[model samples]
Target: MLEMLDNPQLVKIHFETHDDLVLVWANGAPPLVAEFVQVKGAEADKLWSVADLCLRKKQAVGSSIFEKSLDRDQHEETACFRIVTLRPVVSALTPLTYKRGNEARAIDCDEMVALKADLDGRMPNVVSKRGNGTGYWLDNCQWDARHDEVAVKTHNRMRLFEIMQAAGSLLLLEHIDILLDELRKLVKTAGDAKWKPDKAKKILTRKAFLTMWDACLAKLKDDAAQPSGGKLIEKMSNASLTGTVVAMAVDMRLDYARSVRTSRYMQPDEASQLQGRVKSEVQNLSAKRAAGTLDLDGPAFHALCVDRMDAINASLPADQGDRSAFLKGCMYDIADRCLLRFDRTGL
Candidate 1:
């Protein structure tokens, strides 16, 4: 399952648990913790319906901003958060007549902040809870005080992994686009197409991408190092590195298009479409691998991309959008083809 996550744009993994997980938005932002209504046994179903209705109402009524604090930046910050409680369906032993109040409870915004602080202190190396723990697996945490030798070194390695994960999330596409702009200007002013290829090739090399990925990967790896990051880092290898590089290049193109001055100048839908297609195909490949179809980059992949491109071109409307979008299409084709070939042929 871990190996399957080759490239993720936005992924939310659901876990079965009663422990509340806090979501802290961009920095200095008040956290939001989803509150579940307690529903015992069969009453859970009724509460789930009620909670759904409440969420719909909240959406309809709209939210009003509430000022939380004015920080040292002189920015008058306002935070508007709503607490939602849902009684989700569990196992047969945890039946449907379950009332939300009996089965589950949600922590408020304040409680979430306190929890974050507590978790940060107690599980200094741990990031967030991925899932539940059981008997022999009770000490399932990534960071353990018990294992002396493996604990310390592996913990640091986990930190690096978290750094990479965080780096991936940081949305450095904007910076890449900015740099691309400078590169374009330099090329245009020089009036030398010959020079441009050499310059661009230098920018888009494995070494360059690796350097940047290392920096971001380090940051992400650190943030979730101890338990979560350790698990993730253990999954990384040459194939993972290649996927990361491909994803970064695609990300650069997407970011560039999003920053175009006019909406027509860059169409995000194109990139989004391509992203969706690639993600689906990758997932399918992962499924095939699981089913004993170990040849990931076989003929199946080429057919997938060919079908994908046909769909993309079919959906295109007559408009000259950003070059990056077109470039991305080609990049996706080449990257996926190469990835599959590499997967099949090996390094």
Candidate 2:
């Protein structure tokens, strides 16, 4: 799944298909290419052998591991097959262990000949189709083995962290836990049986995944950008504010943070200008209080808040002139950060 996320060419991912997972990629054209993967959680002591992969359930045809993987093969779209397991394969299958290079894996001529003979003996008709079925399978199939679940998870987290860093994420190390959890939930939801017959729900497109990823990053940024309410509540309490008013103020501060973070209903430049204007107003208000012209009373604080809201609203264009609540929220957010004060004492 992490690999799919890292791949730029990947367009869609399908879970719990004929294969364990399927990855689709496109190159600005008609037919789409796909890679079908079969995941095996084998015991540590087990080793995959040619005979084991060819073994059929109750002697039934097309029930073997190799046959099942080949069943997903379609001539309509160019596709490759893969078997990923936690156990190693026999020495005869060493060619499958080779890493992906120009192709999925490098197949030795002698090894392919012997494997083809073995598969041909087991399923002559199936192995002889499309000129040479075993040859095609040998060319496209990859065997990725000895993957420890815990190690893969750790690597996935590291990979995700690297991706976030490359994308200039401001999220901290602790936030990776949240992001990973969300990704896990997304995969689980995509694989849910209830969504069967609706491929849209079962498959995630790259565009949709990117949008979701951006939302997750934005939420982390918003959470980090917002000031904690504890100090704000204490300062408001010192100002003799009612509990209800203090709670409302804290909520407004959160609203302001989200609006600024998302640039909600505003262009990026407009949002920045509004924030700069609010900060300038805050500094001016602080200066007035320091000059002893502004009284250190709850009524005075309320009046100043309303006055600033009105002033900011008047400055905005006609379309945005009704954002009094948003302007007040911006002031409350400044107060939350100790940049604005309502009382004489700097509590």
User: What lDDT does each candidate get?
Assistant: 0.33, 0.72
- Residue lDDT tens for model 1, 1-347: 11112223112211112211111122233432222112122323342321232232244331211010001112122211222233332221121232323322222334333433443343234212322211111111111012243554444334433342444432222323333344345324433333345534222323443454456445433432222222222222223433554445445434433333123333334444645555565556556765666554434554454455555555656574324354344434334334333234332
Name the candidate that leads on lDDT.
2
* lDDT (C-alpha) at residue 313 in model 1: 52
lDDT of 2 at 120: 74
List residue ranges in candidate 2 displaced over 4 A.
Answer: 27-30, 42-44, 100-105, 128-132, 195-197, 228-347
Task: Indicate the residue-level lDDT of 132 in model 2.
Answer: 44
Candidate no. 2 TM-score = 0.62
lDDT by residue (tens digit), candidate 2, 120-237: 7876767523344876787778898846878877776678766654654423234566788888898888778544466777787888898888798777776645567377777777
| The best candidate in terms of TM-score | 2
Assess every candidate by TM-score: 0.23, 0.62
Residue pairs with backbone overlap in model 2: none
